[model samples]
Target: REIERDALRARLRSHTGSRAELAAQLGISERSLYRKLRSLDRPD
Candidate 1:
């Protein structure tokens, strides 16, 4: 689920839209997106 979320974020980022807009398109709140990104990047 985390990997999928990261890939979704990357795909959204590649589009010609602002981060806010991309988060909207992904159907997640912008704060939630940021939280997810941070969680995914955490070290083991």
Candidate 2:
């Protein structure tokens, strides 16, 4: 799950889109995506 999370975070960082749009691409809620990101120890 961590690996997937890292990959998703990386993708989120690289892509040029609103957080809602990126979350949609990953099939997760925008709020959930923010929570996941907040849980991370490092900033992108």
Candidate 3:
């Protein structure tokens, strides 16, 4: 799950400009996408 978190963070970091678009393409809600990102940076 942590690896999944990292992957999503990297994707968000590298693809900053197109997040909402990418999130749309990925078939997930923007809020859900952001929640995944928070998980990566949050304290364990």
Candidate 4:
């Protein structure tokens, strides 16, 4: 999960599009993307 989160963060850093676009590219809703990010920030 940490590796996945790191990859997501890297992708976000390199992506120039809006969050919605990124979410669409990932096949997830914008809200789901935000939720995943928030969860990744929490201690496991």
Per-model TM-score on C-alpha atoms: 0.62, 0.74, 0.64, 0.81
lDDT of 4 by residue, 1-44 (tens): 88889989898999999999999998999999999989987999
TM-score winner: 4
| Clash list (residue pairs), candidate 3 | none
Against the true structure, candidate 1 has what lDDT?
Answer: 0.77
Candidate 1, residue 7: the lDDT equals: 89
Candidate 3 segments whose C-alpha is farther than 4 A from its true place:
none
Worst 10 residues of 4 by lDDT: 1-10
lDDT of 1 by residue, 1-44 (tens): 86776687687668897768877988989898788778767764
TM-score for predicted model 1 compared with the true structure: 0.62
The number of residue pairs in model 3 that clash at the backbone is 0
Better of 1 and 2 by TM-score: 2
Query: Which scores better on lDDT, 2 or 3?
Result: 2
* Predicted candidate 2 versus true structure: per-residue lDDT over 1-44, tens digit per residue: 78977797699779898999888998999998888878785655
**Which model is ahead, 2 or 3, in terms of TM-score?**
2
**C-alpha RMSD of candidate 2:** 3.2
Worst 10 residues of 2 by lDDT: 35-44
Task: Give the candidate number with the greatest lDDT.
Answer: 4
Candidate 3: worst-modelled 10 consecutive residues by lDDT: 9-18
- Please report, in order, the local distance difference test score of every candidate based on alpha carbons: 0.77, 0.84, 0.77, 0.91
